[model samples]
Target: MIQRIQSLYLTLTGIIGIICGLITDFIPNERIDMILLLVVAILAFISIFCFKNRSAQKNINYLNIIINLLLIGFMVYYLLITPGGDLSPKKGVELIVPVLLIILLAMANKYINKDEKLIKSVDRFR
Candidate 1:
């Protein structure tokens, strides 16, 4: 039930994000918003790879957690700090895809939990 709910949420997020991204040109003022949607869409896409139950999935999950953390760290740095240049929308533009990628990785983690072998690896979101 939770999986279905999450899946549906992700599907909606993905669709809206994609649509927003496609119309980015028309909505120049919405670059940041569009980018966020794009990220959600990307996450949803990666979340489709879930598995089912496995005790050995810890290492994989741990690895994913690390990567997700790193990605988030980078995102924070990129979004919050500017080296010396103007702190403007243009500067943050570079972070769009990376943020999207991070969200995708998180979604992938969720997806990995679907493997029967990895089912045991997951406690919640069942």
Candidate 2:
């Protein structure tokens, strides 16, 4: 599983998610965003081990994408609704993490699909 490119991607995604959650303070005095990001990280970590279950892996990635999307949406909404909330460089940088995670998860899903296709093609020869 560790040898697969998707596994590596998933691992990286999870690590980055965790790091972002721990290091970045996106919202003052609110742990909601941090909690959500950590959840995504944990899901990615667990999905990495489901190499034998392509369907489950794909579904988990889809779910991960949705969570990331929601995270992005929440961030945007918070920024828009809060008074005196400006897109300073520091706060703006925090927004990028979810986008990066979304991209990584999509890439991992693409590779997982490719692997699934390859396995199917090889099995047809039997």
Candidate 3:
């Protein structure tokens, strides 16, 4: 489980999600964004232990990706509505967190798929 590359990716995704939650104050809607970030983190962590079920793990990663995309959309909407227009320093490290999460989750999913294909090929010899 822990030795898998997808597990490592998921772990990083969880950590990033936690960091995003901690830095949520910079975003316009702190409460909602923080809750979402924490949820994503929890889901990522939970999925790590479900390595026995690659399909379930992949589904969880897909869910996380969707949530992160939603987060990015929320961040963009909030950033655009802020007073100082594009001139303000509203964009912060928090804005990049979701994108990073998505990338990590995608990589994890890729590895998961590769593992699944490999398993399928091996099982065919039985």
Candidate 4:
């Protein structure tokens, strides 16, 4: 059940991130917000790729974490320092996709780590 949930989460996130990217493509790009979304889309794709190396999923987790942080940082920079600054809080829909991707990446990594640990423990017992 846990493994299924994790896989589902990762898959869902990847799908959503891709959809978000496509949606963002329609919005007019003025201040490079799309850059952060691109980072998110890349990381989301990486999350799916990590499935091949379930053992090295830990390392992939680390990489994904770093990417997520970079995405967040760029988003923050756009919001606080950039000239226009993030769109109106209540009306800002662009922020949703990247932020959702960040949360999904973090959660997916955590789930992968837990799954790895469980498998390792089972191996030890065997």
Clashing residue pairs for model 2:
none
lDDT (0 to 1) per candidate:
0.48, 0.85, 0.87, 0.59
Clashing pairs in 3: none
List clashing residue pairs in candidate 4. none
- RMSD list, candidates in order: 8.4, 2.1, 2.1, 4.2
Q: Compute each candidate's TM-score over C-alphas.
A: 0.34, 0.90, 0.90, 0.63
Write model 2 residue lDDT over 62-101, tens digit each, in one string. 9999999988888888777666635544444567888999
lDDT of 2 at 12: 88
* Per-candidate clashes, comma-separated: 14, 0, 0, 0
Stretches > 4 Å off in candidate 2: 24-29, 85-91
lDDT of 4 by residue, 1-126 (tens): 324555666666667655654665433443354554555556555656567576565565556556656655656555565455365443334556556665766677677778778888999998
Q: Which is better, 1 or 4, measured by TM-score? A: 4
- Given candidate 2, what's the lDDT at residue 33? 84
**Error in Å for residue 34 of model 3:** 0.8
Q: Per-residue error at 107 for model 1, in Å?
A: 13
1-126 per-residue lDDT for model 3 (tens digits) = 779999999999899888868874555678878888998999999999999999999999999999988988888887777776565565655677788889999999999999999999999999
Model 3: what TM-score? 0.90
- Cand. 4 Cα-lDDT: 0.59
